[model samples]
Each structure stands twice: as structure tokens, then as C-alpha cells.
Target: MGSLGSRVLRRKAGLPRGEAAAAGKGGKRKRGGAEGTGDSDSDGEAEREERLLHLRGRRKKLKSTSKYIYQTLFLNGENSDIKICALGEEWNLHKIYLCQSGYFSSMFSGSWKESSMNVIELEIPDQNIDVEALQVAFGSLYRDDVLINPSRVVALLAAACMLQLDGLIQQCGETMKETITAQTVCAYYNSAGTYGLDSVKKKCLEWLLNNLMTHQSVGLFKELSINLMKQLISSSNLFVLQVEMDVYTALKKWMFLQLVPSWNGSFKQVLTEADAWFAERRREFGGDISFLESAQGSAFLPVFAHLRLQYIISDLASARIVERDALLPSEWLSSVYKQQWFAMLRAEQDNDTGPQEINKEELEGNSMRCGRKLAKDGDYCWRWTGFNFGLDLLVTYTNRYIIFKRNTLNQPCSGSVSLQPRRSIAFRLRLASFDCSGKMICSRTTGYQILTLEKDQEQIVMNLDSRLLTFPLYICCNFLYTSPEKRADSEAQLDHLES
Candidate 1:
């Protein structure tokens, strides 16, 4: 068989028998099988090895070429296709790589005016987009390895957003998540909101909800803008240990900081600064006082507009507010009281018989006791004197009944309150019963009611219901106001009444 195979191989090779045998012996031994089968297998294996080696060489060359291209376009800027001017610095960039961004794609492709230019001048109108951020953003397109830290992530995010780079935006968001803490989150949230980075904004807000009451959170609150503050305070997701009063106090601290210029000290310092500024202005204006009052009132109106006064639990927390009169304007305090009163009245009207009607003369005497006071001692006269919607009234409430007396005080009304005259203020009240575990057992809310006093009425009194006397019961008040246009009209009427 071997001889026949050798002869057949010799014939195919067209070689003499002896010469063919010599060549076969030499090649066959190297190939490692009998009858030359090994020669074909070895040749195939050699071809595969050569192909693999060539492929590896080509890959290395391609990688080197890519590196060279990046260097030429970025580091050297030799033959760069575009010029990006950000924050007064010029960056020479390649249009091909930059075109990966929607911003660059739109500018360089299609019928846009910049498409035809070899040297495109790119300018992001925002001053926050700095050159270093641009460098990081541009570098990331060509390389897989990019570094993002807390310090540079904000600027990079801003630049990436402006450039419409979704991938880089996502990367920045991930970096922000890794870096977020109570101290740094607010700054990141502000940046995200400013740049419209919704993903990062959401994460920051969620983080805030969890960490809002921490000692570190005060730093964040100090830096929050009025609009942001309002957004946070009004958000349903915000969780606080003491929902009503702690939030109110934090809001007050924020507002005081906003009102006082260059204020770095405590809330007391803020009040002092405000007082000094007002006094200085009054003296400067020859004690005219009107302009200063108006300016200060306007400043505070926006701040107070965001405060949810009705949510404040009216027991001990509100009592503290009464003691620290400087924390809120008297008129704001009054609005809070009125809201609570209206809520109580609503609860009573819904859960029990409608308000116990009393003759106007019954409450005529100054400081007349209304319903029987609760057994608990101590002054429970919940008094607040702030404008609510279009009504400017001094409100006082006790365990038995609530009193609303139209405030005739000469203090100028701040625009923060609704100016429209409301025919009546509507509100709801809930009496919550809690168990020993501090969980609510049952809650009863009153049907909505509109409390309207007669034109000649000095005070309107509504009696507390007997059903609300259960131990561990909480009276929750919610106030509803008229629409803005209606509020303006009501405010005008109240202004006339005051005059």
C-alpha cells in the first residue's frame, strides 16, 4: 500500500521514482504521518497559522493608525476639520469624530450653514461650559477609558448636554450617583436642573428626600434657590422626621438667608441684618418707611408663598413659632391661623352638626371666652395675623371654638397673600385617632365648607364638636383659596375695608 501510494504521488508530481521517494521521505518525515497524508494536514495547519499571524499584525497596525489619527486630530490638531471656541479657548477637532454628537451632526451634515465649512467655529452660549470640560468630552469620543470625578462631573455634564451627547450624559449621571452625598447633592441638583439633565435631577431629588433633615442637609438648603426651594417644599416625595414644623423652620432659615445679603451667620444674624437694612433705608428716605416696607414685603412674599402654613401641626410646634415672632411675619402667622381655623370649622361642620350658631353680641366683649376650654392647662390661644388670599384678618383659636376678627391694623399688606376678595374661604378638617403604636386607627374628615362672615360682623365664631374630644386625637386643617383673579378682587375689597 505504501509503495502504491508513493508511486501515485510520484506520478502526480511527474518525478522519477527514486527522486520522488527521496523527496517524499524527507517531506513526509517532517509532516509526521505515513503515505503523505500528514503533508496535506501540515500544509493546512501552516496556512492557518500564517493567516492568524497576518491578522494579528493587521490589527496592531490598525490600532497604531487609530492612535495616530486621534493624536493628529486632537493633540496636534494637524489637519483638524473644525475649530471649537468654548469659554474663549479654541479647540481644533475632527469633524468625523465630532459628528458622533447630534449637535455636531446637525451642524456638519444636512443643509445647515456650517456643513460646508472646513473650519467650523463652535460656541456654546453658556458661560459654564469651560475648556477643560470640553477637553474631557471630546477625548471620550475616541477613547474607552475616561475619568470622571465629583469636581469635573458637573462641568462635563453641562458640556455634554449642550453638545447633545447622550452617552456622555449618561456617564456623567453615573458618576454623579457615585459621588452624591448630602453635602454635594444640592449643588449637583442645581446643575442638573439648570442644564435640564432629567436623569441626574431625579436621582438628586430622591437622594434629597432621604437625607433632607440631616445636619449636612442644612448646607444644601442654604444654597437652594427660591424656585428650587419651593419645588422641594411642595414635593409629595419629600420625607421629614417632623413633617410640619421642621420643614417650616428649614424654609424660614432658607428665606432669611435669601433676604439678608452676605449673611453667613445664624438666623438671628439674618434678622439683625434685615432690621439694620430696613433702619438704614428708613433713615436714608427720611423715615418715609413705605418704600422700605414695600420692598421688604415683596421680598418676603415669594419666600412665604412657598411655605405650607396649614400643614404645621398647631400644638407645640406652632406655639414655638408664636414665641419666635421673628421667624415669620405677623401677617403670615395670621394666615396660618386662619387656615387652621377654617380647617377646624370644616371638620366640625362635616363630622358633627354645622357650626353652633352664636349671636354676634355673645362674642362682643373683648377677650370673651368662647367654648369651654380643654382640661389641659396653659395658654392655647392660637393667634396669627397674616393675610390669606384676599382677606386680612387676625385669627384666634381655642380648644372649644375658633374666632376670625377682620384685622383693622394699619400695616401695609404684602402682595404674597391673595389680593382678590374671596366671598368665603373653603377648607376641610380631619380628626385622626392613633393607637398605642403611634399608627392611625381611624380618621374622619368634614365635608368642605365655605366660611363667610357678614359685612358688619366683627368676629365669626365656630364651636368645636364633642366628637373631637377623644384622647390622642389630632385636628388636621387644610385651607382652600379662591383663584388668582378672584383673590385680587377680594384683596381690593379688604384693602378698602382696612382703609
Candidate 2:
């Protein structure tokens, strides 16, 4: 090596010959003398290239073309090629980015009068579309992703549908479906119907079916329209509480709210207020015509027709309420009484054991709907009141399991028990648990099945997993306790009406 002072001066200038020699020797030692300095130098080159590649990747990610384009081009309106005016607001936008929307593309590509214009005025017919929704809808064109807020989804959906933005429309539909609660379900359902979002509409209907009765609310009752109430009552999928009697009771409360929407009160007070209101109506009408036959109630007659009066009148208290309310026409009750009398005779004298097989049509139209709520994870047993054609089925919940017992001699029942050696009934069991917002946390269903039991026999209807068990579980059941009957009675009623 050269003198230390000279070597130091040369090192500062550039890699001198002496320093290169020293580095060569160090590389040989690191790679072993046999491999020489060539392999070591190649390793150094590879490491440097890898470091440069990582730096380039980080720089590219930081730039984020989507964000840059959105901020500069959309927000700053840089070099905008066209202008859009709607809902008393204006936007400076580029046609190239706007073409991502089908509406703008059609306008530009077609032989329309406004195709070549630098500014275009849009007609916004949907009342839901507002300025904020239009801003978000326009901004989404330049951004790679859009964040949807549940509260603003309806308005955004209206804007997207008007602009024919399929991706944004689909996102809005997904957001609505995911956010459905008692407060939002009716609005979502109505918007879905208007926008032709079939999947979202179906999801809203399912949520309503599960929660309408299991978790009733004054807001929901007020929101439910006459036509929607008709649809819900006419379907077997409705989750009724207690029995058919409870369904009529709910309708009476709902009808009261429909008429007196401003009368806000506690849930327990609904029935008392409804009775008082109807009593006033009775006095006004001179108490001669039934409420359902009168002008005010005739509009709801179609909904009431779906109630299985045979099940409702089986209990003395319920029948008495039906008589006292005078909601149904006297002829309506008389006809149901005659039909049920024959059915009772068939069960007692004709040896009608019960339903032998599941008749989907018969069950969907006339099944006895009922439900119960389990407060926590524990052992409990209960029974719904009504004759149930003397089947006397009892429901039990314990150890995360639901059991259905046929009471004959092992357990005392409120109603008469069938003494037959074996009896069959068609049933469908459903259980669900909800979060604070009325969103379903977990749910299960038995669909539709037929179960046969010997005297005092019990069977496991549902086995809950420990992982999925939650407090305040609601269980709803649809039971068809009698065989399907001929349609002669219904046809005769229609015939009388036609005359």
C-alpha cells in the first residue's frame, strides 16, 4: 500500500488502485479463495438491484393514480371538457371520465341534439336524488373505489339509477340489504321496488317476516302501508305470536295507528287505545253494522279474510273478543262457525287422527302460526293455548336443544290430549336471534316436515351449537293439525258474493 496520507487523499477523490486491491482481497476472503472475487461482486450487484426495485414499488404505490386523478381532475375540475347541470347544482366534468356512465355514453354516441353541446342540463325526476347524492355519484366516476354510507344509500341509489351506473347501483343495493332494520326495512323495500332491485327487495321482505311480530314497534306499525299489511297477513311466512288470536290483535293495533298516527304511546297501551277508538266508531255507526262491513273498515276486509277464524275462535276468550269488537260481519262469523262445527264432528265421530302428510298449499294458506321468546340460555317449557285439534304438543328448550313433546299421560296439558296410539301433524319450526339494531345475528329453520309420535313421546326438533347460542332467542312455528279439506265451502261463499 501507498503512504497513509496519499491513500486517504486518493480515497476522497475516487476509488484509488490501492483501495481496489484491498477490496478485492476482502471479497476473496468472504467467498472463499477458490471462488475468487467474481461471485462476491455478482452478489453485491444483485443486492443493489433488489434495493432499487423496492424503492420503485414504494414510489409507485405512494402516487396512487386513482387518488391523483380524482383530486386533480374531479375535485379541482382541471381541464374539464363538459358541464352537467341538475337539481339546481352544476359540475365541471370531463366527457372521457363521464362516459363510464351509460347515460353520458348514450348522449355522446347517439344522434341526440345535446351530443355536441359543451353544457347539458339533466332532468332529475326522482324525488330522492339530491345535490349531495349527485356529488358522490359524479365523484365515483374518477375513483377506483367508492365508500357508501348506509344513511345516504337511498339517495345515492336514486342518482345511480338515473345515470345508469350499474356498479354504483349494485353497491347501493348491497348496502341497503346489509343495513335492513325495523326502521329502515320499509324504506328499503319501497326503494328496491322502485329501482327494480329484486334481490334487495327479497331480503327486506325476509327480514320483515322474521321480525314483524317477534319484535313489534310503533314506528314499524305506522310505516306499514295497507297494501303491505295485506301482503304480510296473507302469507304463511308471518311470524305470529301466541296464536291466530294474537294476529288479529296486532291488526287491530296496527289499524288504530294507521288512523291516528299522531297518537304515540307505550306498546302496552296500544290495545287499550285501539279498543276505545273502535268503541267510538261503533257509537257513531249506531252499533248495527260490523266495522269490517262499514265504509271505514271495508278497505281492510281482504287482509282480514286471510285470518284462519277456525283457529281464532277455538278459545273462549279470543272468540269473546272477536264478538265484542264487532270487527267482522256477523255473517262472516256465522259461516266460519258452520265450517268449524263440521270439522269438529269429523275429528270426534269420523276418527280424523290428524294431518298425515305435509300439504304445502294447505299449510301455506291456513297453518296456525305461533311464536315464543327464550330470555337466556336455560331450561324452559311452555305450550301455546288453543285446542290444536287435541294434539297437545309441548315445546321445551334446554342445554342448547329444542324438544317437542307429545303430551298424553307423562305431562299435564291445558287442552285435551289425543289418546290415539300414534298421531301425525305437519310442522315447520324457525328460530332466530337479533342484535340491538334488529339485525339477525343467527337463525335456523326446519323448513317443512311431518312428525309422528306415540302417546307421551318426545323428539329433538333442533340442536343448537354452543358457538352460535345467544340470549333472547325467538322461536316461531307453523303447525297444520288437520287434514286438507275440500274447497266447497270457499266456492259457495264466492258464489254467494257473485250473486
Candidate 3:
């Protein structure tokens, strides 16, 4: 009897019906033959299976019923078709039920001492729920009163993800991406380079690469600041980005271009010098040279920074477009070269015997001497300036001059040297290019003063006799070349500094 009652209680707890009748009928049964026992056992097994199936069906129905109850209680059955509870419930979901009524709060939290509590609620039919009310409620959750504070952006993202609110998730992600600081970005980079929110991770990668490749602020990035441009180029492997030559080329050109307007008239000079400095370091801390090499093809930045700088020697020697025999107006040249001259003259107005008043003869002689200082060497290297085929071929030396031309390409002609000495030595061009070195024969077109003299302290002018000079003539000139002794002394000075 005791065992029977316990069995009845167990069956009653498990199933709501038939347990009392089964217990009342049960007691003892006599043993029977094998066939009868087998038949009876089969019938019992079938009944047990049926009961299990029924219980499973009931549990499934209960799930659907619970979801419907919560939906109607809180969401007003607006999402009646949505299966909200098939997925495991989140911690905040209980709060959702509690907010609906005191009865749910007491039942769910297991604090049911106050059983008399009731809700003053009106039944809202699913169809009668005003669409505007739902819209306004969701809108309140989505609305922004200010630029969403970056500090709260992550929290908003977590909530959006948990709630499956895609729109809010996207908004928070975009806001965080936009407001991210370099420090924060580096932190994200250190931690596998994502916001840890899966939805934004893909979009964040796109944003980060776009910024790395195109943002103006990339120039200010600390990696670029400390000569770590290579790191950016290499670390981009994290994204499997093939660091193309074009991208690197574009980055380098863009960096130098930003400095252009700041250097003003000397933009080209500054850019070239900057490139040279970068090149030296590049070789020392070597990587692909093609990165800098691509700047040659860049069109956004001017190829030549300062037109006045006649020659720019760069890492890549062949990347220059030089105009030969080009003519520039003397006044324009003077404006560029003598910007400080008038100012200096103005300051010297009161002193009669100022530096400018130094005898024109001496000045000319000294300049010619300086200009010819390098002429003693056979090669006579001059920094090439544009040629003037008109009035005279101008070669810039210590002073400007008009030079006489000579014989044809195959046969060389010699010319008579004319030197006039004043305070400075000046050339009065009545010289002849002889056909033979043996005799100084007079060439055609005499008295053509192809050379002229002018005094600007550091500059020289050479006027070429176009009439005498034939095509492909041998012309030699020099400027800014120091004597071997001077060269050695300068080297010593540099060595001293290095030491």
C-alpha cells in the first residue's frame, strides 16, 4: 500500500489524469504463459510511448503559449507571429514581463507574498493597437538629441546587438568609427583590429583601409611621423591587402604635395630636397625603392617644383623633362635672383662708398676672376640653364656674357681670345674662330658683340654670338665649381662635423 501510494503520487505529478484509477486497480497479478506475458508487455510499451509523445506535444504548446502571453502582455501582440522565446531568454527579458504588471513580477521573481496585487489595465486587441503608438515608442528608442556620445557608443551597440536592432547597431557602429581616436584605433588594432561587435567588424575594416589609403590625416599618423611608413605598407598584410605600387606612389606624392603651398615660390626646391632626404634614409632603412620611384609618374603634384632651379638630381636619374635652349626674359630672371638686392641697396643709401659702390671695374674683374676660377679645369662644369638662341646664347657664370660661336660639327675652328681689364676683367667681343689651330684666320661676321657684362654680386651673364656659333658647337662654361684645394677644405670641414 505504501509503495502503491508513492507510485500514484509520482504518476500524478508526471501526468494530470488516470493515475488514481491505475493505482486503485493495481495490486497483484498471477503469473501467466510466455505468449500472454509478451502480448501484455507489448501493449504496455505502446501506451508508454503514446504518453511520452503526448507530454512532448504539451511542452511544445506551452512554449508557444508562453511566448504569446509575453507578446500580448508587453508588445500588445504587434509581433504575434514572431517566435520570441524559441531562442533562450536574455536577463533583461524578465524586466519586460515585470513592467507589464505586478502579477508577472511576483510570479517570475518568486516573490509572491502580495497575492492581492492587481493591474489597472484595459484589454488592447492586436488589431486595435494604434500603429502610431508603436511607431512613436520605437522612434523614442532610436531618436538622437545630440551627436551620440562616443563614450556611450559601445553600450548602444551591445544593446542593439542583443535586441537584434540592426538600424541602431549600424548607427552606433558608424558613429564609433567616425569618432574613433588614433589611440583608440591603435588599441583596436592591437586587439585584432575590430570593435568586437561582429556586425560592425566588416564595415570597420572597410573604413580603416579607406582611411589608411585616402585620409588626409594619414599624413599625421604616428607611424608615418617616425619614418615607419614601411610598417603601414607591410602591416597592411593583416587585411591581405596587396600593397600595390600605385597606392604607395599615391601616398608618397600626396605627402609631398601637401607641403607645396607652404614652401611658396620654393615649392619645387623644397619638394626635391625633401625627396632627397627621404631617399637617403630609405636606402639606409631599406625597403622597396619603387614606392618613391612612383612619384615620377604622379600628376597631381608638379614634376618640377621650382622652375628657376635648373637641375634636380634625384634617386631616379631619368625622371626629368628638361627644356634645352629655352629663353626666359632678363627682367623675370632678375626679379627671381635679385629679390634682396633693392632691399640691400635701400639700407646702403646713406653710405656713399657702400658695398654696391665698390668700383664697377673691380667688381667686374673680381666676378670674371671668380667665374674663370673653375675654367682652369678642362671640363668646366656648369649647372645647365635654359639656352637662349635669340639675341645671344646666355650662360650664367659669375657675370652674364655674350659668347661667339665657331665652326661646324666635323671640323673644329679656333677663336682668338680677347680680354679687357677694368676694375674687373671684361670681354669686348672682337674675337675670331680660325679654321686651323696653326693660323688665327678671321672667320666671317666680324664685330658681332655676342658677349655682354653685368654686375649682380653673385650672378654672371654670358652672351653668345649666335652668328658665329653653328649647329652642334662646342661650348664650355662653368659656375659654382670650387678649386681642388677648396673642395678638399670643404670635405675636411664636413668630416670635422661628422666626427
Candidate 4:
């Protein structure tokens, strides 16, 4: 028997032991000395070498194209010091590419990198952009300084605005304006408004109105265009109307005459004519008459008056944003009309007992005292006139209790609501709250303080959150809450009532 290890020797992996073993799996065997075996092995090795060479060539091309970015963004040679800037950074080409590709995010966010990155670097990141390929695609259209086409400048400026690059956006806007006409300005009026470009809106409105004035009228039928006219009127204030007086007057006259026998427009025209009649009446009365006051004789007047007052107050508020600077400072005097109304109502209602007067003089004195107290409380003192929900109610109900007490720890005021009583007066006062929603809700108290005036009425109703109550408070407080000066004046005026 061959050795039990014969199979093991047959499986040996190195060079063949004899000539018969040199032939592949099943070929005929050639028996010779070691020279024949050597020649056969050399042929096999040569073929293997050729295969590996082909694989290496393929791998080299794949690695070059797939792993490396081919796109290059060249910056100005003069601005080499600046390199690239994107999203508030300076970056090199490779880093920019990495950023564009998203590979640099971990690196960028890992620690603060001071490198300046360009817009392209910020935008494309790691994506390969072969310059040669881009140049071919662009042909003669490519410019050295700008990466985008001339036609896309507006879009680029818009992108700049989205990125919050104020300078770039403005520059683009100016450039477009320089190259275009009033037509472009008119086209973008709404866009300008959306952007809150007050200047742009002003200019666009001027252009549109000027053109309309030259035509003396749009000549559009009232039935077809009443809505458009209403929208235009609503978009602006008296100043805009005055500027486009010709247009406004024509529209107003046409609107006013719609109720006359010859009128033949849509329901909208009929409505405008009716509105003009009432507007003229309102103008003569200095404003709309209260439905309740007018209704003293008419059964419908009370409900109509209250509803009209609410509507007027709401309209006044909506008009504030557009009329901020247009109206005179003295017009602010009318702001407290509501507060005065409530105060007079309260004073008359409770006339049977308690210190009889809580009016302008007493309110002024108390406000001055409070101002002194506030001045002592912090480094800054703010006094405002107009309306404050809390202050107005405080002065109206418990006018005697309002006083100034300086809290001397020198700590800043927390500006929260408090009910502090001194002598016979109970002061339920709230410092302004920073929370916008919380600020809207005024407060009231029922329990008691040292000073109590009991009148046997139905009830001391204090639903401050009710719609009727809230709107009045809003009307009283909206302008007054603007500044400490206004609040101080209002307080002083109310304090005078006490004296």
C-alpha cells in the first residue's frame, strides 16, 4: 500500500513534484526533467500577469474620476487675500468643495473654522464640477467675475435676500431699478410690500398713481373695477389719498353719486354711493355719531351705537400702522376719549357716597407721585400718555388709592400686577407684562381693601375678559402702552380728577 499519507501529498499546494503533475486538471502528462515543468509554469504566470495589468488600468481611471472632484471655481486673482466667503466664512477651494459636497460639515461643525468660503463653495459642497466641462457648456457666455448669467441677476438678488445678505439684495434692487422703468417698479410693488421695503412701496404707489392721474381715470367700469378701487383705497392712508388726490377725488365723487337716479353700475357701485353719503355725514359730525346716543329716540339706536363704536375702534386700530407718522401729535389727544367716557360713567354711577371726585386733576397728581416712585425704583423712568388697560381701570374704580411708593432695594421692577392699599384707597395695578398674549388680559379685584365704597347696585360686574370690556380696554390702552411718557401724562391727567 502507498502510505496512508498519499492523499495528503496529492493535495500539496506548491510546485508540482513531478512532470505528470504539471499539466492542468485533466491534460495528458509530459514526463521530462524539472526543465519541462519550469517552462509550463512560466507560461501560466505570464497570463496571470496580463490579467492583473488590465485590472490595474481600469482601477486607476475609476479612482481618478469617482473619488476626486473635477469642478473648480476660480476666484478673482486680486482678491486672493479674501479667498471665498459664504454664509459668513472664508474658505479655500478644496475645503469649499468639501463643504459643497457635505463632507466638511462634520469638520466645519467640529470646531469653529475661520476659513472664508465662496457662494459656490457654500452651495455645491463636494459635488464634482469640472471647470472644463462647465466652460464647454457655457461657451462664450461665461464671465470671469460673476458666476451667473446677466438674465439671472434678479433671481440671484432674491437668493441673496433669502440668505439675509442685505448689501447684496439692495445692490441687486438698485441695479434692476437702474436698468428698468417704472413699469418694473409697478410690477414689483406687492413684492416690495411683502419685503417691508417702505421706500419701494412708496415709490411704486407714486408711479402707479401718477400714471392714473395723467389718464385722469382708469376708465374701467364701476361694475368691473369697484373691488380694485376699494383695495387700493384700503392699502393706503389719507397721505396716499392726498398724494393721489385727483384719482381719489374722482373715485370719491363717482362713488358718492351712485345713489342718484342715473346710477347704473353693480351692487358694489350702489354700496359705494351709500357709503359716500354716510361718510359725508360722518365727516360733518367730525366722525360717526354713536348709535346709542343717536338712538335715544330710535329703538334701534342702542344696539347700533354699540356695534358702530366697536367697528370704529377696530378701524382706528387697523389704521394705526399706515398712519403712524402722518397724523399730528395732537390727534393723540382724542385717544383718551374712551377712558374719559368710562370715567364719567363711573363717577356718576357712584355719586351717592365715597370722595365725590376722581377725574383729571386727581389722576394727574397720583400719576406724578407714581412717576416719582418709579423714578426711584430703577435707573430709568418711563412715563407715557394715552391708554393703559390697568391704569385706566385703576383710576376709574379706585382713583383715590393710586400713589407712588419707591421700593428702595434698588432692584429692577419685575413688572407684574399687584394690589397695594394705602389709607382709604385700594390700588389694583399691573406692571406691563412682556408676554404678548398675557399682556392682553387686564385684571380686576372684588374682595376689598381698607377703602371700601358700597353702593347697592345690581352687582359690581368685573368681567374684564369679555369682548365688550376687552375692546374698550384695548382702545384705551393701545396707544398709551407705547411709552412711559404717555402713560405718565395719562396718569397725571386722571390724578387731577382726584384733587
Top-scoring candidate (lDDT)? 2
As a whole number from 0 to 100, the lDDT of residue 330 in candidate 3 is 32
**Candidate 2 per-residue lDDT over residues 272-321, each given as its tens digit:** 99999999999998879999888888988888888889889888899999
Pick the TM-score winner.
2
Candidate 1 residue spans exceeding 4 A from truth = 1-73, 78-92, 111-116, 215-219, 265-294, 302-313, 323-499
Identify the superior model by TM-score, candidate 3 or candidate 4: 3
Q: Write the per-residue lDDT of candidate 3 for residues 330-405, one digit (tens) a residue.
A: 3433453353333223233422111322233332222111111122212232322221111112233222243323
Candidate 2: C-alpha lDDT: 0.86
Weakest 10 consecutive residues of candidate 4 by summed lDDT: 474-483
Q: Which stretches of candidate 3 lie over 4 Å from their true place?
A: 1-37, 44-48, 77-244, 249-499
Alpha-carbon shift of residue 496 in model 3 (angstroms): 5.2
Clash number for every model?
Answer: 16, 0, 27, 51
- Lowest lDDT 10-residue stretch of candidate 3: 318-327
TM-score of each: 0.51, 0.86, 0.25, 0.22
TM-score of 2: 0.86
Alpha-carbon lDDT, every model = 0.56, 0.86, 0.34, 0.33
TM-score for candidate 1: 0.51
